[model samples]
Every structure is written in C-alpha cells, then in structure tokens.
Target chain A: MESIGIVNYWIVIALMMIALYIVISANNLIKKIIGLNIFQSSVFILYISIGKVGGGTAPILLKEPAVYSNPLPHVLILTAIVVGVATTALGLALIVRIRSAFGTIDDQDVQQDIERN
Target chain B: MIAIELVVNFTLLGFLLVTALYISQTNRLFRAVMLFGIYSLLTASLFVALDAVDVAFTEAAVGTCIATILMLSALSLTGSRKEVRFRRKNATFAVCVSIALGVALAIGIMDMPQFADPNAPANLHVAPYYLQDSYSEIGIPNVVTSVLASYRGYDTLGEVVVIFTAGIGVIALLTARTSKPKED
Candidate 1:
C-alpha cells in the first residue's frame, strides 16, 4: 500500500518533470507554451487531490445528509483556471507581437539580429 | 496515510528536480522561460498536496500563468539560450548550496505535523473553524471565497492594490512618448 502511494506521487512528479523538460529543452516557441500549460494543469491536479478526504462526497451541504469533500479547493481551482486562460491569451498575444517585431521566434535568431544591430 | 502522503510529496518534488535540470541544460531561451513557468506550477502542486489552497492558487495563476507569458514576451525580444560551449562554471557551487538548503528545509518539514492528522496544529487551529463555519459566517458556499473575502480580507485587498499598481505601471510604460531604443 505504501509503495503504491509512493508510486502515484512519483507519477505526478514525473509528469511535471516531463512537462518542464519539454518547456526548457524545446527550441520552438509553441512547444514552450504547451509545456507551460501542462505544468499549470499538473498543479491544478495537485490542489484538487489534496482537498479530497477519504470517503468524502462532493462538497455540497445537504440537510440530514452527511459526507462531503471539501469545496474550498474546487472553488480555488475554478478561479485559478479562469486566471490561467487569461494568462495564456495574453502570452499568445505577446508571442504574436514578438513574431511581428523579430520576424523569427527562435531565441538564437533574434539574439543574433540584436548582436548584428 | 503517511505512506501515501510521502509518495505524493516525493513524486511532486522529484518532478520539480527534473524540471530544474531540464531548464539548466536547455539551450533555448523561450524554452527556458516556459520551463520556469512549469517549475512554478509543479511547486504549486506540492503546496496543494500540503493543503495550502491559497498558495497553490496564486502559484498557478500568477507564477505559472502570467509569469510564463511575460517571460515568453521577453524571450521573443532576447532570443534563445546560448549554446553550451565550455565546462561548468560556478554551477557546481550554486547547486551544492541550494541542495544543502533544500535538505535542511526538508528535514524541518519532516518534523512537522503529518498531513491531515486531526491532532496536527494546523488541523485543530482556526482552520477548522473556517472550514466548519464559513457558510454560516459569510453566507457563502465556497469556504475559500469566504476566507479570502472575509477572514483574510485585508491581505486580499493588498493584493488588489499590487495589481492596480502593476496596471498603472504598464500603462505608463506603453504610453510614454519618445520611446527611444527599447527593442520591441
């Protein structure tokens, strides 16, 4: 049981690592953005997982009924998801502007242009 | 319970470590920025597992999301990371110091109350009251909203101020006349 739990933990962590690696190692701008999205989703999963209590039901309060998972985390994650989408929009907007300005999105190419100037 | 928690925590931590390595070794600037965002997000997950909802939310929103976008914008202007050329320089020293500090913190955390132990200080403190009475106290179903809007109202207001200030700064930066040579 203990090992199973540990494996689950590692699996989440491993996904995070894979996403991070893609973000860092990829030369493509789009790939980097994808990695960012993956990373954020991982955190979202973490928040939702922590809030779950064993044998707990959904967090809605019901009269004469019992057992509810904590609603707080769900609420928090909802807000966070909204924020994430907004940020992604802004980020893409910036990327568009960047492409227009530099004519190339690759980091090295832009830097070379700067150096030449 | 402890075993499960430990596995979860370790998994999250392990992912973070690998991501850090990925960032350090990557040769693309845009990719590095994205990785930094990913790193922030993974850390946020760890916070959630620790039952720190507020922290996890902030990390997910500001750190992973907004921060990543800003970084990408900066990357567009700056270009990719320089190709790895020579031997390691100062990296070993930096890594050793950081690792030492991290280990120290982990040791301290080991002494902390077990995750969700009913008798733990955090579980028994004002947190439970907030969890139990948030609905009645504020007439809100979402306990986090009640806590943020009411219990920790002052802090939330401060955050709003910070955001307001940031907006003002952006406006000024964008609207300034005779913007000389700041590339893009």
Candidate 2:
C-alpha cells in the first residue's frame, strides 16, 4: 500500500508546516513561541519516525538473531528532547522578563515603541 | 503495494489541516496555547507510529510537557486576551516564505529515496551492523545508548554545550540582581 509507505511522512511534514506557519504568522509573542514548540516537536517526530524499520525490535541488541531499530536516532532524540526543554524554559523566562521590562507582549507594539523612543 | 500506508497518511494529513486551521483562526490566546499543546501531543503520537520510542519519549517530555509549560509561562507574562489581527504586510511575508519553502520542499522531496523501501541506501549502510552487533560490541544491551555514548560521543558533547549555554543565557536574562539561586 502506497498509503503505508510515504504518506505518514508527508502527514508529519504537513503538521510541521502548520506549526511553523502559526509561529511565523502569529502576532502574539507567546503564541508564536507556542507555534515554535510545535514546529520543533513535529521535527522530532519526523526524525524518530524515519528511524523505524518495519517489524524491527527495540535497539537493545539481543544475543539471539533479531531485528532491531537503529539506536542512534533514539539516543539523539533523547538529547533533542532535553535540549528542547532547555530552550523552551529559556524562552519562557525571557518572555517573563520581556513583560516586566516592556509591559507588553505584542511584537509590533514593542517595535513601534522602540522606534518611538 | 501502498494501501494501508495511504490510509494512515491521509488520516494524519486530516489532523494536520484541522490543527492548522485552528491555530490560524483562533482568536483567544489561551485557546491557542491549549490547541498548540494538543498539537504537540499529536506530533508525539506520530513519533510513536514511526516506532521511535526514545524520540517519542522525548517528544512527550519536551514538546508536550516542558514546551507547554513554557508557553503557559509566557502567557502569564503577557496580557490575558486581546484581539489577534494578522497584518497584511505580515501575510505577504508569510506567503513569500511559504512559496520559498514550497520550492525547497519540492527539491527535497525529489532528492528523497522512495518511502520506507528496505533497499534504500540508508537502511543498507551502517544500520545493519548497528542493529545486529551494537550490544555485543559496546557491551550495552541498549544499542541506542551504545551508539550515542560510544560511536557518537562527540555529538553528545556538543549537545551538552548547547544546553549549558542556553541555561546560562536564561539565568542571565532572569537575574534581577547579582545574586544567584544555587542549582540542585
């Protein structure tokens, strides 16, 4: 089934693009950040999904002959998740500071005000 | 040859379109944040469908949990709700970017190997040994762990540095005074 084949990957990519559009198009800073998080997440899924081999077993490397997933993607994804969390935390904290310093979170307003100053 | 894959792909595509519409049309900030969280969750599910347990775990943890929390925190920093308007100039910019991305995607799709074909070069190289002998070679039952910590140790190091730098930057940004909170 062609559906079983490349379609899943395309679906994943579409989700990613939607998230990216939200991020780029959203005027609200927080929403934009939210969009970005979704975007990154979909990418993560894309990478993880690509690592899948049909009927593959886990990457634990059994002594007996067996099918196993590529472990590298799994490990890499673990690191990516950690990095994603760190990035989100940092971004949120920055938003907090931005609110306190600027008294607003709308990007255009921030820009206009800066121009005014 | 491609029936089941087609159905699953279409199903996932439907979800994607619905989510895009929701995010684009939503007026409420809180709702948008919540929808975005749902979006992450679905993406995580996609990872699972892809058979990437480690990546799925991370997506669940980072994308659904941590990222959602951060977005909520950001919401707190901003006003509760307001009129969300998409400016025309911004729309134009988005369209241009979309067109550019479309072209790039077309190029990328052209260059890609046929979907999930076992004979694809990616599946033939390096992967066979890693799958078959990684545990024996590295003495770690978790072949993923072996590959990450042994074969690709330097990659891990780079990740560590990136995270540490981000942490430091966040600390610097959040610091109100010269004082610091001790890390546990």
Each model's number of backbone clashes? 7, 10
> What do the candidate models score in CA lDDT, each in turn?
0.57, 0.68
Considering every candidate listed, which one attains the maximal TM-score? 2
Displacement of the residue A4 alpha carbon in candidate 2, Å? 5.0
lDDT of 2 by residue, A58-101 (tens): 66656587766555567777788788778877887777676666
**Model 1 accuracy (lDDT, Cα):** 0.57
Q: Which candidate is the best by lDDT?
A: 2
TM-score, candidate 1, chain B alone? 0.71
Instruction: Report the C-alpha displacement of residue B56, candidate 2, in angstroms.
Output: 1.2
The residue-by-residue lDDT of candidate 1 on B43-149, one tens digit each, is 67776665555556777777677767666665554453454322244345544544554455445444543333334343345545766777788987656668667
Each prediction's RMSD to truth = 7.7, 5.0
Please write out the lDDT profile of model 2 over residues B41-97, one tens digit for every residue. Answer: 776666555556666666777777777777776676555567777777776676667
Looking at candidate 1 chain B, the ten consecutive residues that score lowest on lDDT are B83-92
What TM-score do all the candidates reach, one by one?
0.56, 0.85
